[model samples]
Target: MRYPILIEEGSDTTAFGVVVPDLPGCFSAGDSLDEALDGAREAAAAWIDAALDAGMPVPSPTKLEDARRLSGYEGWTVGVVDLDQALFDDSIERVNITLPKRILRRLDDLAAARHQSRGAFIADLTMVTK
Candidate 1:
């Protein structure tokens, strides 16, 4: 998903500010444009995660042109923050895969040590690495 963002140019004394218009109350700041945009992506992800956790609906991204027309962003730069759709999906899915016997044994051992199912262990690891 690509969310539109409005950037307030930073001055020597201030950091660049970013607002994700599609996500209400979601914003971020950084000393440089690159940092600011990166922050925006992180902020959007966190916002979506929180909303989902709270059982609230996640808002879809508005078009760049539409976001540009929103009030109070005049003179600010416009950009888009791309997010991985899979990161926000919480649906459960079952799949089959083949693993080497040695690796499978290690995975089962780790899951047992943590008192978690093999699927839960893999899911937890995936989230942490991501």
Candidate 2:
């Protein structure tokens, strides 16, 4: 997804500031335009990750034109950050992890008792523990 960023231009004495309108309270800063943009992308990803991990719904990105038209963003320059769609995807992906045989056996047994695969069990446990 392409999210619009508003960059507050910086001079030699100040750093560039960035804000992601779609994500409330998501902001970043850097010494240059490129750095501000990079920081914004990282901030956006981290924001999304935290929101998803907490089981909160992410806000959809407003169109560039709409974002630019926001009342307070008149003088700031705009930039687009392309976030990977996979970050928002819930699709399963195969992974390999090695565990102690006894622990693996216990996990499998518990998973079977709960009618869920070990991966699903582990995922559920992780979310709950957090």
Candidate 1: where are CA atoms >4 Å away?
Answer: 94-130
Estimate TM-scores for all models.
Answer: 0.71, 0.78
Give the Å error, residue 30, model 1.
Answer: 0.6
* Residue range 1-109, candidate 1, lDDT tens digits: 8889999999899999999988999999999989998898989998998788677999888999998999999998888999999867889999999999999999999
Worst 10 residues of 1 by lDDT: 121-130
For model 2 the local lDDT of residue 103 reads 95
User: Worst 10-residue stretch by lDDT in candidate 2?
Assistant: 121-130
- In candidate 2, position 67 carries an lDDT of 85
- In the predicted model 1, the residue pairs found to clash are none
lDDT of 2 at 100: 98
Kindly provide the TM-score of model 2 when superposed on the true structure, using C-alpha atoms: 0.78
